[model samples]
Target chain A: MKHSIHMHSLFEKLNLEDIQVEDNSTLYGQANIERIRKLTLDKVRKDRKEMSFSFKRQLCKVALVACAVLCIGGATVFAAANEGVRETISSLLGISQEKILKVGESIKNKDYKLTVLELACDSYTGIATISVEALSPKAQETFFKDNIVHKLRISPVGYGLREEAPDEYRRYFSFSFKVSKELNLYPEEGLTFSMEGISKKITIPITQTVELTELDIDIPASEGYPMSYQKLYYSDLGFTLLGSLENEDVNSENCLITIEFMDGSISKFYHYYRALEQVKSDNRISVAKTQASIGRSERSVKNDTAPSDEDTIIDFDTEWFSGGSNSINSGKVISIFSFSKEMDWSTVKSIMVNGTTVRLH
Target chain B: MEDYIIIKRLKQNKEKALEYLIERYSSYVVSIAARIGGRLLSIQDVEEIASDVFYAIWKNRGNLIETGSLKPYIAQIARNMTKTRLCHKREEEPLDEDMLVFSSEGVDELIIHKEQLQFLRDTISLLNYPDKDILLSYYFWNYKLTEIAERFDLPLSTIKSKLYRGRSELVKRFEEGGYYYEA
Candidate 1:
């Protein structure tokens, strides 16, 4: 409480009103304004084009899913017809064909037919591919336009769905769920994928469990923030980096994670998803606070232990595909990076964070 | 143009909205950058900062719709961008001994308590108009005494005297409020 106060610090903290001054007409000429306008407008156009391209790519991916669903007509010819789905799942998850559990479980009502095509999981994450075919024409007409998909919920509360494609008769989607105490899908469990009116609890067939590889890391301090790599869990599904930053004001953007593959390819974990923008628009800081409090209460209830003084979960995932907790509270930070395509961990030559590299043989 | 209309057009990615923004706020941004950087920054640097501020507004158009008014947001961006430019310049080239304001006092480090800072803010709010403006311009905005004098159309000696009186009043208030500044 008793400390010497720097004069500059005092000046920096003062929040004063904007100084009212006469117009300095000679400052910026018409040419300067025109130049800035051109540059900014060009950037705006470029961003719009990029966003359009991204949306089209998403639609194409959805089409692929719809095609996979059409190929597998019924549950009777499940193994033979679901080859495309199996291959797609295999490629998306970076797993082998054998690891995918083909559950062509179909249930129908008067309005729709929902089929669970395939599923893949580890101890920390699970992926399920599903198809919802509109049996009624009315349902088909409103399928792509409405919030019908949001009504469909999975038991493990934190599951997120991505629409692969929507055709005249059906829509294909993939659901990714993170493992929690309430829902542990690994080594088999009864998982329920339900809609508002129709629901089903299907037995998640036992499959291979992807072992997590821990990387030996030592990240040196940089930019006044002293950081120490606590743990690194790597798998084809994704990688999670648990570390601590001594400075409480460390921004999540500064904690850069880069993976260098043996094929001279580099993957940087910094891409922000459109959903994240939506989150920010909806006041994400308050949402983050709510999630943090919920996480604390859940941890305490599950283990019958008190919550840590400053434990919080911060989602830093680009796609929000998985529950990647990029938590930073009282200097403890955890960053999770989920891969969209096949990443051969064995092919990873090194992982660098904030200019510090840790080689993996 | 109204802020809402400009924000709507900006969200729609209309180039005219950006043109309007640049036409309206370029001078204001320039004034802020000039005042903050003073003699340390060149005219080119100030111009670049103004351009960057507009570019930032374009990049963050999605979040602008929620901001009821655009001027405050633009002012904040201009201030931050100007400070960042100055910080980078300082790192690249060290300040001269004559330019160091507090280095000669032999008081190396000071930690201002949060409570005291709040009290200082409250006291500063209570100060008279031109005196408060002069103090803020000199200390907070980093405006040179000559620049402050020219901006307010007062002599350099008058600007210096006003700053001295402002500092004395702040110190007296701090002591009366039971907050002591050692050395």
Candidate 2:
């Protein structure tokens, strides 16, 4: 079936009021507004830093894994979809988020056959649930039994199918890669989906961005509430964020987001990362909650501990924590929760812990 | 003005075209970045991705300009850049773990993502600004519902209910064939 999206393009989907086009300085109250020249210069500065002979280069191929307990549909589930595609993706339409395609539609190529059972298409990622069967018994035995599958790589480099894990049966496989390379959300013609040597491609006629309710929150401010979206819209009372970890390793995935769209300026952003698996309720010396914003701390890097006002870090530690291969029991979850960003302290009307909401106003 | 004219200006003068595009679509870029891998990236990283996306589009002005629309191109570029950024992050600073679990591919659980993005897109387009922005950021950019509710100073209960209502409304619209732009 052809998909017919309502917009001429993805840009048409954005609300006009959200478009802030005044000069960065006037809008953001920044002392200096950067011109394209300075932005270009920053690019030059980066290249120079990279080429400097004294700078040591490191390609840290850390095997970062996000072991999520509590099935809160963890944030990293889709981003770090290194698990069986089945485990991470569910039906967008069904309550269980079931698959869109089925295995009944299988296609074959010479000595082997391929079937695409599921297709997960977002603006950036297109994941296919595939089933492969060898025509010859010998080939099937070698490919499945000995796990001599690495030799047969998927094609076309970046757009090619990656050798993820198979389903319960040895025949099923899943692959996900970038599809927005040609994501003309509103092309003169609609978009299409197809894969070579895998399945027939079809033009997706429609694409819609899901609508959540508009928040009618206005943090009453005397200092004329900061213009930043977060500060203006949500930052009222100070609160903490807690998370459960799949592993206890020095995961560099932890990040802090701070920038002023009004001024088009960036401030000092501190990057901190740590993964905790062993230090849960059993060892964290906590009673009920595995993690709460009040008691969360950094379990890695002790040397240079500098806290900034942009965000808060309450009761933090310096020891690095990591996890083991065995998935921690869901019952006894080993969490690596840390403090996320803090609001304006005064603007918060409510505090959210996990899914539970508390009125703080 | 047509996309080509704007692009022509870009080709002749880099700064002016960039200024225009940036003024027009910076929020759009951030929205998409958040949808794709915004949670993993800092705002600076998102900015870097936006800058690079514009630069790439400018460099390939010939192909895109003729298309007469920069919206889809921008969206596509934003997505590609985010994907690239995520891939790079996975390679360089992916969450550090002692053990790596290989992804499992399944056959029985195979089903289309049910074209959910399409219906959601149309429903969102009908929303006013902040509402549309909130949903886009939450779903496409992976922002937490609670975070979004907090951002808007709304209760988490309110946000979840609205999302539920909006989603239900969208499915109803689809069932009724109400929001089809192509027809």
Candidate 3:
């Protein structure tokens, strides 16, 4: 009664030529294809038009907001100048324009000038926007053309630039660094931003930190994976789950977090490793072993363990849109769940993890 | 119609190219989706999945390689979509028994490794004519036993026996290769 999960995985990896089959066109008539074609073409056209319209509308909105901020004639004027930075901070951090900390810090060389425009940080995550402007035309031609900005590094947590930027602010780039308390990577003092070929470095201090509501509650272990909860820190942006697992085979990916709001709304976050490709390529044997161990653990749980009548096991039907980062060090696992949209943490009634619920209120 | 020509037309944003693609691969997509979905999904569900697969193809036309055959890409999409649909359906209802096949007697014996998967692939390739074809049709394409029987013009019992024998051969090969051990 062994599961065919591995078999399915094996089959998927097979060469296309090996599994080639004759076209059974009789199963689906010509009428079916025609209908599919029409529907697909209509969708493509609609998507294209909508994308165009959306881009134009967003540009207009951002432009208006930028102009409005400039007209106000205050600290916001700096943010208005770097609209790309301001927009990214607003979107990613789920914060208002006023809450965005304006860091008018700059470090320059003969070739280029790098300016730190804005930054937002909490207990776990930090996002900063930096503008790399070429000082000379030659620098612009050689450096910008080659896209050498990726050579820039922010120590401890790596930085990723925002791919899509308005044409007007093509030089503006946003770098985000996330630090987890459980991992002991929290930059209590500041972050060091440096670039290759440049001797000078800029130290952007963590001046302002967003207030996070902390909840300390002990949740009983689920039948499948034996885990103990320690703390839950949540804000308007997202939430973090700090727990310890007795079984190392119980991957954080299987730990589904569902937040039930006071208003009867629910938000689910599925924990997935961001470096999954790296794990598969670099540690294939380890991954296979982990999978096998997980299978064994699941089998034992099913055969030996029994849940009490009060215990309810929730099976999530919907595909989770929000992503969570999981890191396990010495049996202690930290799962940071990021929300797709801004949430009112006060309105949350209870948080459930793998069917075990802990009331917050 | 050739896959390259169809890919070229798709890249050019020609709607008729999509029609050609749908006409050529609709049956193939439907077959994959139907086989994967099995009794869990209705005819309409399978049809919807087929449409979605085509739509995905059209959407990713720019990324499609003009030289390579589109069958693999289409097959992958069909499998993915059908599996995703099944997962969502499983959330709404009780777990599908076929999907949640547990190991007997709580023994943690069978472990599939990357090397073993490669060995399985090699073994599958070396299989004799109709056996190889039947195995691919049954496992890779996820064709039903009855469907394989009909396609091969063989009896259902013969098809089943062939599949069982093929699997046993795979196990034996794996054991000899030191990739698998019987419990």
Candidate 4:
């Protein structure tokens, strides 16, 4: 063991591990870009590439849309609302249609169009659904085909999470986020949507709130693996989970949190449904074959066999043990200032699902 | 955009230039920050360090060297900032000896090593995801074999056996790349 492998090369080779730009490193890139987008361009207000003109102008623009709030009967909600916008809002904000107050409005400039189609509100959840469509058909073609985006600084008027559309939808990009309670109040004023080299504001508003039922989920120690754990927090629209494995030996082998809602509608939450949808997509990274197939898992290494169709490569990151839960809690849980009341742990009935101990009060 | 163009824009006090650089080198910045911070800094802390690195570079744009590339400069700043954060968290003076890995190496040797490093990197990408991740994290990130085993929920023997295969794969790549290791 006197001569060992030089650790330096490996260190440097893995240098960009966190970035992995050669692959889909969007998880990190999105965060960094979002942060940089907040940095003001300090240019003319007309071009929004991350510049804010007057706050008053932003407000007045949204206010100009007379029917910022659309009145739809409970049964006619789907018929009255734009399907694309409704889906975008529900998917983006992790809200249900019932929670929306106003939707389907637009503002545009010469380059891109911005529309706020759905606004869901709770006392604190002000999730706005906004869509930006490029004016040029050629630009839209490239966007849809290549999945490349202009270095536009698109910021929600509030503090919220952003979920961008897929490549095909990039030309008519849609996003939703939970904004600050203050920002929610001014939803009529759309966000400052800026392009890589241009800028503009889109006037629209989506506001309505749903009080999701919260329950205390209690788990017995036996439910978790020696070092693996799963916590599923549910709301009306969807649930969230914080799955972690304390045991480092597992290459993320076992993480299960199956949900059973009172309604057979597991599709109620956008995030959960989306994950299932992506896996359903023909290009999904399918589950890997168990190395223990022959009771000799080491064969995977020795034979150096090309991975079988049964053994798909898992591009996994152990650090992000959290998944399956929808983006936001049941419904409009956006807004920094909105705080929902907690569930009383004592009132829930304890139950079991697949040997996982759970308290469902 | 070219490095020179970005530098020129930064010099002109255009904030978007900084944004462009951030988008381009974000992965590089994150890797450096996480490496230097190790397990000491939280994600928030590491993020702040990365932000500080970019801002520091932008702040001192006038002093940048006009040759080569800005990558090494950015890496140096990122590592230094991370070290500062680590020192603050540990409440100790910077340990220069621990910071230094090798006292010196021949210039030619260094050059060859960097070249070979490229070979290692390409091979890393070529390897399947699981094997690549196992080798890189175990060797580069300083994660213990047991730690990895626990994290991935694999048995200890399985990890060691896989690691042995990973090393063999490494050796195979070295031979293929026209280099020999003194094993």
What are the clash counts of all predictions, listed in order?
3, 51, 1, 34
Q: Could you give candidate 3's per-residue lDDT for residues A32-126 as a string of tens digits?
A: 65566666666765664443333333332332343342222110000000111224566543466565678878777777677777876666645
Considering only chain B, report the TM-score of model 4: 0.49
Q: How displaced is residue A203 in candidate 1, in Å?
A: 5.6
TM per prediction: 0.39, 0.25, 0.42, 0.27
Instruction: Name the 10 consecutive residues with the lowest summed lDDT in model 2 chain B.
Output: B89-98
Q: Worst lDDT window (10 residues) for model 3 chain A? A: A287-296
Per DockQ, the best of the predicted structures is 3
What stretches of model 4 exceed 4 Å from their correct place? A1-98, A101-110, A121-128, A136-195, A199-208, A220-233, A242-254, A261-361, B1-183
Candidate 4's residue-wise lDDT over B68-172, tens digit each? 478888887887776566432222232121111222223465565675567567666676645665565465555666666774568978877776776666567
Selected candidate, larger TM-score, 1 vs 3:
3
i-RMS for every candidate (Å) is 11.2, 20.7, 11.8, 14.7
| CA deviation > 4 Å runs, candidate 3 | A1-88, A91-94, A142-149, A158-161, A167-169, A180-182, A220-227, A252-254, A262-265, A271-324, B1-183
CAPRI-style class, candidate 2? incorrect
Choose 2 or 4, whichever is better by lDDT.
4
* lDDT tens digits by residue: candidate 1, A1-361: 4444444457676543433322232343323655655665666556544533333333333323332332221100000001111124664444666766788887777777877888776544556788888788888777777555555544432222345436567777665544422212222454656565675545554443565666545564454233555566666665655566665443333333445668786655332212223333552221110001001111111211111232332223221123233334445554444444434657867665555556665
DockQ of 1: 0.07
TM-score, prediction 4? 0.27
